[model samples]
Target: MADSVAVEDPKFTLQEVLDTFKSCLSENKEVFLEHYVAGWLGLVRFMNSLGSVFSFIAKDAVNKIQILINHLNGENGAHYVTVQSMVKYELDNQLVDLTKRGSFPESGCRTLLRLHRALRWLELFLERLRTSTEESKTSVMCSEAYNESLSQHHAWIIRKAAGTAFWALPGRATFFDVMNVGTPEQVVAMLGDALPLISEVYQVTEDLYVQNNILDLP
Candidate 1:
């Protein structure tokens, strides 16, 4: 299946985006790489809806997603089935460059690590949005979320660009309405329901990265 969102729906509802991510988590709590990438694609759509200021970040995320999709369609595609399986396959077969950069610049481990870090930022930002008041500043919330999660991985230029994008964020009420999930109450309720799944996926991937000592991959 194509990693891109379906064309049948030109606009994305927040619940639909959350469901994409939620579907990534399997019954055993393992995350499927295909579904996870799809979830990010959904998020990119959400970012696009926000406006052109966030296009740069969405572009970077789309590039990463395409790289993973290439691997998923490569000769060793079966090994790239799920996040857990891909990590094991790469580590066992010596496909990842643990300490230094090598020919495989886009190793599965490193690529997933970047997305995994961003996932935490999304989770935090969403939670903040869910609980925030009508008068809350979205730029502040977004910058705080970025600082606490994805900022460490980014350079000064990227951070500055991201800060600018955050400043372009719509008001809290507008953001909630764009979700297309009905009233503010409904949006919050949906966010509450979706957060645990996102948290579990992040924690599971984080633990896997820590255990294998590839969290700091170059």
Candidate 2:
């Protein structure tokens, strides 16, 4: 049986985004792609709201995502289909800058790597959100997940910026409301359960990277 999550009153806009994510994760590959792109666009907006510092990283992320989105929905998806191919395309074109010498420091590979790294964090966070026995503070869960995953790969500046974003996170009530799940309390409980599965996915990826020594594959 499918586990059903119910929310009493959902705030339409952002909640729809999260709802879309849940739907994507649960079913619908094309929708999943769209939601992923939409979710990052929101994230970029959220980061931009912070300050100039985040603008740099967010700009890089947004650019790379736009590239991927174009490839996915464009005429060149066949060549940019896989993460590996995307990396090659970006690097070969000199679109990626491995070191931060100027505005664009993240290559498609590195940018994707950052997202890939964050994916682990998202898995952990969602799992935590899914399985919680009580209402969870999305801020806390987000920070905790980052510490274990994305934050490690980030430099000092990014860690500080990401931490700031975590603190700026909406509370459980708003977070769940945005998620369109039934009731904040119920959603928290669900997150607690979901977190472990997400962690498992993160761990598996982490292990694979460590084994291949491809931590910097981008």
Clashes of 1: 0
Encode model 1's per-residue lDDT on 12-64: one tens digit a residue: 78788788888887888788998898888788887888888888888888888
Q: What lDDT is reached at residue 133 by model 1?
A: 85
lDDT of the candidates, in the order given: 0.87, 0.56
Task: Give, for candidate 1, the lowest lDDT window spanning 10 residues.
Answer: 1-10
Tell me, by lDDT, which candidate is best. Answer: 1
- After TM-score superposition, the amount by which residue 140's alpha carbon in candidate 1 deviates from its true location, in angstroms, is 0.7
- Model 2, span 1-218: residue lDDT tens: 11221222223343444444453342221223344555556556544544464566676677767755665666555545444455445556666655444544544445555665777777777766665544677778888988998787778997897788677777656566655547766666555554554454345445544654546653
Return the TM-score for each candidate structure.
Answer: 0.95, 0.58
Give the candidate number with the greatest TM-score.
1
TM-score of 1: 0.95
